[model samples]
Target chain A: MCFRDAAVRLRAQTIWSGVSLEVAPGEFVAVVGPNGAGKSTLIKAILGVHALSHGEASVLGLPPGQAGRRIGYLPQRRSFDASLRVRGVDIVRLGLDGNRWGTPLPVADRFRGSRRRDRERVAEVLELVGATSYATRPIGQTSGGEQQRLLIAQALVHDPELLLLDEPLDSLDLPNQAAIAAVISGICRDRGITVLIVAHDVNPILSYLDRVVYLARGRALSGPPSEVITSETLSQLYGTPIEVLHTSDGGLVVVGHPEAPAHHSDRHTGRTHERP
Target chain B: MIPSAGATGLSWNVADDVRQLFAQHFMVNALAAGTIVAILAGSVGWFMVLRRQSFAGHTLAVISFPGAAGATLLGVSATAGYFAASIAGALVIAAVPGTGRGRGYTNQSAVIGTAQAFALACGVLFVSLYGGFLDSLNGYLFGTFLGVSDRQVLTLLAVAVVVLATLALVGRMLLFATVDTDVAATRGVPTRLLSIVFLVLLGCAAAEVSQITGALLVFALLVMPAATAQQLTARPAVSLGLSVVLALVIVWLGLGVAYFSVYPVGFYVTTFGFAGYVLAASGRALITWAGTRRRATPAVTR
Candidate 1:
């Protein structure tokens, strides 16, 4: 996807301002920033959901909405009509296919398509995301972590060349985070699907990203992950010197404003709902 | 409930009467109205479930009651009164936030409760001026066909078709918007307009159900089939279709039971509809169990 000087404007405020960026084919990129940054907007703009008040953007050379059939997008969260109960596999089927009206159940006359036809494809994506065993579970019954993986699978089911994931790892534990990251990296490394993921902290996706774009205060900075993931650049972006921590578990890259009040991480341990 | 049939009709113990029943003027009118109302109820109720607005469905039913009663007192068209009150209530529901998962009925309940009380209070005032609503008032509260003319049935069918056609056209997108409305809007599914359209349809459905079964028995037309459809399937497309099918069956069955048992059709339909949901759930469990045994052993060909 190539986004040149793309800016998104909403009625109330400008989300992405004068944003110019490029994502090469098959590149694993992370559009990372703190809360309220234009990372989400920039992505939605590329997806053509939000109108670009400024520049041109394309996915695999086509406009975002036009390119939907070829691009897999995992939104922040996917909710369903409470009464429209569906199994996990069916959720992914919507993505695997051409992002059609919805995954309608088996009926006599309606033709079958790649979305569900990619049965083995569903299993492959499931295994990649470590949600293989939960395929039969109703999506509502799954835990947040499990649901996140199913969402990623739902994205991959279509087998799009470009995957845009917004906050895919939100509210996940470390193990689940690692699993999700591994699945994403595996897709980029093995399947040649370009990944553009959004995240709050850079530490989780640091190892997977070739490039990380930081957005703050309506401005953005982008470069190779190695050069861009730095305390000085982060401090300037946030306007406060931040600590760059290297966690004991061979993890590195965390930056936050020093003067700002430090908040506790709200991570908790919980299992995915075990459905009989 | 009130299971008394024609206390003065000669057809009391008539034998093997298909033509006698299906061809009767009153029977035809009842069947036509029930079928039309059932179709609209099933379709709109499908979205009501998707939007998780059963309470909205129920409250709108409550709010529209006094309209029909007021009309009865004023000797005007009950349908007109119900239509006005229902559309008003739909607008009120729209102003309430989080129509989705409206199990958060507390705030909406307060608003609806106030609306219901005010509407009924005004209706009581109207009734007093007229000095006796009598059987007509009972008809609006519980529902009796004593007041339904054939023209009313035709009018119900006309409104029913319009609502169904609009819903059918926007069927998929509406379902998409109903589930994760933000995503659907992001995908350019016209979220805001769809919400208004859906509420308007609800208003229309409420009016029809309110006029026929009275607002109290609107659930016979609105909630049951859709709720049963929810228990049966989770797919929007499937559940939508199932709701309609279930509604058709329930309406026919309820009408049948009402005829034999001599009761308000709404009472029989509502009770029977709840029974259907219970049956569907248990049937679903049984189907799952039987299917699992066939695939009990996972096979790895690779």
Candidate 2:
């Protein structure tokens, strides 16, 4: 996946401009930043949901959205209504053949082999995500971490070359976040699937990520986490006196200027300030 | 009108009553039409409820009222008007941007509500302008099995075939787009196009149900069966099948009871459907309550 001097403008305002980035196959990349950083917009632009105002972007050797069949995407966090009766396995199966024109034939048909293969693939992905136990249950009844696993399984059911997950770890508890991060990291390594994950907090997956793309103030910087998440780089990116602190356990904590109300409120609020 | 026939009154003998129920030509036509309407409405309403587009479905049903009334005033077939106006209303609703979320959903609801209100007003105006007989008006509003003809039965069948075929072709993709739209789009599902197509199909289903259950109580056949089925099961195939079966039973029972009573078929249909929904809902609640209590007892003992 590659972007060359790409820019996106929504409602006459530039979200991010002149952003150039590339990800190699099987690389685990994380897109991180503070609020209003257009992290999700970048994912959308890459997926061809949002058109770039300038420059060009490509995925899997084709233009954005052209290679959709070869891409698996998990959008930002969405809570299923408690009354929703859809099963997790069905959700996973949808990811495999949901775009097909007709419904699946019964087991008595000539296409029984293909149908079995579809079910097998769904089962395999569910197992890979460690959600096979509760996958038959209603998705709404599952815990947050379990639902996330099912969604990731859905994305992985059809073996895609590239996976784009927007905030897959959002709203998850710390242990579940680490566990999900490990699963994603394993998929990237074993299946040779390129992953671009958009996340707010980078602590949980810091050790597993191959690279980081940090965006702020409509600009982006991409490098190793160690280099890009430093005080100097983030402060430069934010255009303010932001601090990146290193704890004894090798985790990074980002603190913004206390007096700068616009950026400061987001650091501790836990509320995601989405781009309008 | 046909003269009063033998065995019109309900009897204690179950088989005899059923035989009497299917004896008449009009009864057969009504049964056929009701069955077709039930299958179409049940299948389409499953997706309607799943997508949370019941409001849009209701609006389409309301729009069919004006469509049928206007067609009557214009000396055209009411069925033709139903199709035309319902599809047009669907297009208008589809033209509004947004995929039923956030600010766009609010605007979409406002637009749908306004269209419904205008449709009701237009239906009243058309009825008043025609100054049709009170019986025909009542038939249009509350529905009548006696008025269902062999031609109407065939028309309903034709529409059902087309609608169900189209639904079968698009049902899988539609389900994916309905549940997980953003990801479906990213996976090449054409979410926008599917949305429009589903709405048009829903409009057709609503219009078809209106012909049987009447404009005022279309939800009786369209929503209740599917809603009740979802309460009974979480499995898509099972729930959808249950929805169709429930609809079939409701329509059959409604027709049978209305045949022997002074009340309209719509009242009977709506009453039976509501009863089914209430039963399913309470059954679900009872099961949940029992399971929680059992779990709580185990924990307390531990």
Candidate 3:
């Protein structure tokens, strides 16, 4: 995945601009930011769900949304409808053929070997995510962590080369957060799939991450955690006297930064912002 | 056979009465048309219920009233008017710009509510101007099974087939999108196109069902059966199939009751559908309560 001097604007206001980044295959990069940061926009841009105002971006040699099934995306945490009756495994099956347009005629596919193959693949993915026990359970009835695992399984079932997850750890407990991050990191290692994860907190994925793209005040600084999570780097990015305090457990906390505006422009309009 | 009913000269013979209900040509047409409408509404309405778009579905159904009335005033077939108006209504609702998923619901409901209000007013105005067809207007609003002709049955069949076939083609994607739209879109499911197409199909279903249940009572068939089925199962295929079966049962019973009585079929259909929904809801609640109590008892014993 690559973005060269990319910019995005919504309603004539620039949300972010002049952004450039690249991720090689098999790398796990976390796009972390403050509330108004353009992390989601960056994901949207790569997915082609949002148009870039300027610059260039390509995912798997195609522009954004054009990458089609080659890119697997687990969007920001959202609940399935309570009445949605699909099981965890069925959701994985959807990743295999959800985009295909054809009559869901059962008789035609009964004798097809590919159908059996798809089911095996789905079962394999469920086991990979440690969700085999709940594979037949309704998704809505599962816990948040379980549901997140199922969603990750869905994204990974097709074996995409690029996996983009938006805030997969949000609302999860610390243990669950660690477990999910570990599961994703394991998949990335085993499958050689590149990953870009949008996260509000950087601690859960700090160990597995190859790089961190920190966004604040419409600017981004990308490098290893030791290089980017320092007090000086984030303070400079946010234009504030932000302090990165190191916890006893070897975690980092960003403090003294201004509260983000309630309405995040990029989230609403799929635009990007740039530092003035 | 006491002389208590001699003044009315009416008797109840279940088998003969049922035979008589389907013996007439018009009655057969009504039965066929109602069956088709029930199936279409059940299939499409299940998705609408799952997507939480029942309000939008109701608005589209109500929009058919003015369409039918306007068609009468223009000396055109009410069916054509029903399709045009409901489809137009669906597009108008779909055109609302969704700022984001969280904020989109409020905007969509506001837009749909405004459209529904305007449609009701237009229906009233058209009815007053087309006074010559007041009886037909009443039929469209309250429903009449006796007036269904063979041609109408054929039209319903064609519309049902098209709607069902299109739904079959898009059902999987639609379910994925409806449940997890953000993820589905990023995976290249064409979520926007699916939304529009589903709404159009919903419009077709509403218009077709309104012929038998009337504009106001369309929800009786569209929402109730689906809601009931969902309450009973957490499996998509089972719920969808159950929705269709429940709808068919209610429609058949409603038509039979209306044939032997003086009331309109819509009344019986809506009542039966509502009853099914109530039963399903209470049964689900009872099972949940029992499960909770059972679990709690084990903990207390331990």
Q: Estimate every model's Cα lDDT from 0 to 1.
A: 0.71, 0.85, 0.82
Top model by lDDT, which number? 2
Off by over 4 Å in 2: A104-111, A257-276, B1-8, B99-104
Candidate 3 lDDT tens digits, A94-194: 88877777633344456788877877888899999999998787776778788889999999899899999988887677899999999999998888999
Which runs of model 3 end up more than 4 angstroms from their true locations?
A: A16-18, A53-55, A83-86, A103-111, A235-243, A255-276, B1-18, B99-103, B132-134
Give the distance in Å from residue A78's predicted Cα in candidate 3 to where it truly belongs: 1.8
Instruction: Give the Cα error of residue A162 in candidate 3, in Å.
Output: 1.4
Error of 1 at B3 (Å): 11
lDDT of 3: 0.82
Indicate whether candidate 2 or candidate 3 has the larger TM-score.
2
What's the best-to-worst order under DockQ? 2, 3, 1
Question: Least lDDT summed over 10 consecutive residues: which range in candidate 3 chain A?
Answer: A267-276
Candidate 1 structure quality by residue, lDDT tens digits, A99-132: 2443244562145554335667878888888898
- Model 1 per-residue lDDT at B269: 77
RMSD of each: 5.6, 3.3, 5.2
Per-residue alpha-carbon lDDT of model 2 for A46-133, expressed as tens digits? 8888998999998888888788778889988776766788899989999998989886434323457778888888989998989999
Query: Over 4 Å off in model 1, which ranges?
Result: A1-20, A45-71, A78-84, A89-136, A156-161, A235-250, A253-276, B1-20, B70-76, B95-113, B278-302
The collision pairs in model 3 are A15-A272, A15-A273, A16-A272, A16-A273, A16-A274, A47-A65, A48-A65
RMSD of 2: 3.3
Give the lowest summed-lDDT range of ten residues in model 2 chain B: B98-107
